[model samples]
Target: MLNWDDISREYQSEIENFQMLNTPDERNVRAFLQNCALELHERQTAVTRLYFDQEDKLVGFFSLHNDLVKVSPSLILEHRWNLITEGLTHFPAIKLHYLGVDARYRKQGVGKYLMEEVRSIAKEISNYSGCNFITVEALHSSLTFYRDRGFKLKDSTAEFHNMLFSLETLDNPTLEATPLISKQKIQEIRDKVMSVIEQSNLTYAQVAATSGLDEIVIEQMEFGTDVDVETLASVCQSLGIRFL
Candidate 1:
């Protein structure tokens, strides 16, 4: 089981215990979570979110802030470029300041889950404002990781590689539809998922393993967390629960 929430002082002790790979970039990630994440959060400079695993131990975290991406005209689609002013190239973006998963959870989809959450948050922000992309200053060693996840390098020669993921690749539900999701509706869905889980008498881990997903994924569904529809469908199928 894994859960995420905004960072707070109560997590200081756990944050102190958090560990990452020994590489320089991973070290900086740990240092940021310990030394700066909360302060930055308090100041409203950057908002940080922490991930905790089954034992309620802090295992991962990431910080995000609003940003602007300046690029040449050629870099953007003509229609997108046309949305900008005659001379300006700045595009609204959400910057991922730091992202790190515990060294122990590295290959178990923690990183992938964190990235998905970031992208989901970016999309939600897009519904309220003009968020066109998610940007990150990538470490050289992690270049391939980000690249494989749909981020494109803005400049290979830069000290910190600038990577961008165009949000246009994701579906943009109409504004009317966005506001239609009320808490009650969300609770109903969660209850439905729980009912299905109870009927199946299968644990989250069992369904997750059969569905090729993390146990936390099923837990998230039952807890009313926002999950991709594909994941929801897969979990349902795994439990022999049909969608109406």
Candidate 2:
């Protein structure tokens, strides 16, 4: 049986490799990598990370929401499930975020296996949350992937497809998440990153001259301005940190 240890290593490698986020004619892979890494890192700050592996490699991941907002008039913005209500808690929205696969294993059966497991988990949690919907933001390339699995587009902007599925048929979904064991790892990374930003420590400005703005942007991550996910993901790899 492939276990969580194998999955962790494989997943980390893939997130590092996620730096290859584009093709020849597609978007800027380097730029997108940073933003993706940052989003995954921040999302983990308030959400749980699920893990899964194949024989010797970790290939998939999912996030779970542990908090909820009440269901009421103000909370119900049209079909939206607002989780910021003052004091309502009948059913809460369990938002699914940042689903990705290892680049080498993308076309393999691993992604679907992990996804089905997560959906089943959501179903099991339904009794605990009044049957909340399971939702995800799908990349254009992955839209068919979700649709084939019975998910439909809930909403869409020009760039992403927001999709959903009912959690009524959750099976024995074998997955669980634990918090990362090291905040020191984060701090250690912060030091190297700070070095890059401080400039006096960098030997070569070329190496210091990266295409992404991770050093500065990280300082202001909480600001409303949009930071590039692709760029931050690359910075994470360089800084030796795993976004999971």
**Which candidate's lDDT is highest?**
1
User: Judged by TM-score, which candidate is best?
Assistant: 1
Instruction: Give stretches of model 2 more than 4 Å off.
Output: 5-14, 18-55, 66-91, 169-244
lDDT for every model? 0.75, 0.48
Error of model 1, residue 80, in angstroms: 8.8
Model 1 — TM-score against the truth?
Answer: 0.66
Error of 2 at 55 (Å): 5.3
lDDT (Cα) of model 2: 0.48
- lDDT (tens digit, per residue) of candidate 2 on 1-244: 2233212333545445442334431233333332453454455643434344544454545555543423444424543433445565455446666565555454355566777666766777776656566766666545545655656566677557777664532442222432343545444545555565455444223322342222234443233232233333445565554644
Kindly list the per-residue Cα lDDT of model 1 for residues 161-202, writing each as its tens digit: 788888876664221211234546545656777797788787
* Candidate 2 lDDT trough over 10 residues, lowest sum: 1-10
Distance from true location, Cα of 3 in model 1, Å: 0.9
Question: lDDT score, residue 109, model 1?
Answer: 71
**Lowest summed-lDDT stretch of 10 residues in model 1?**
172-181
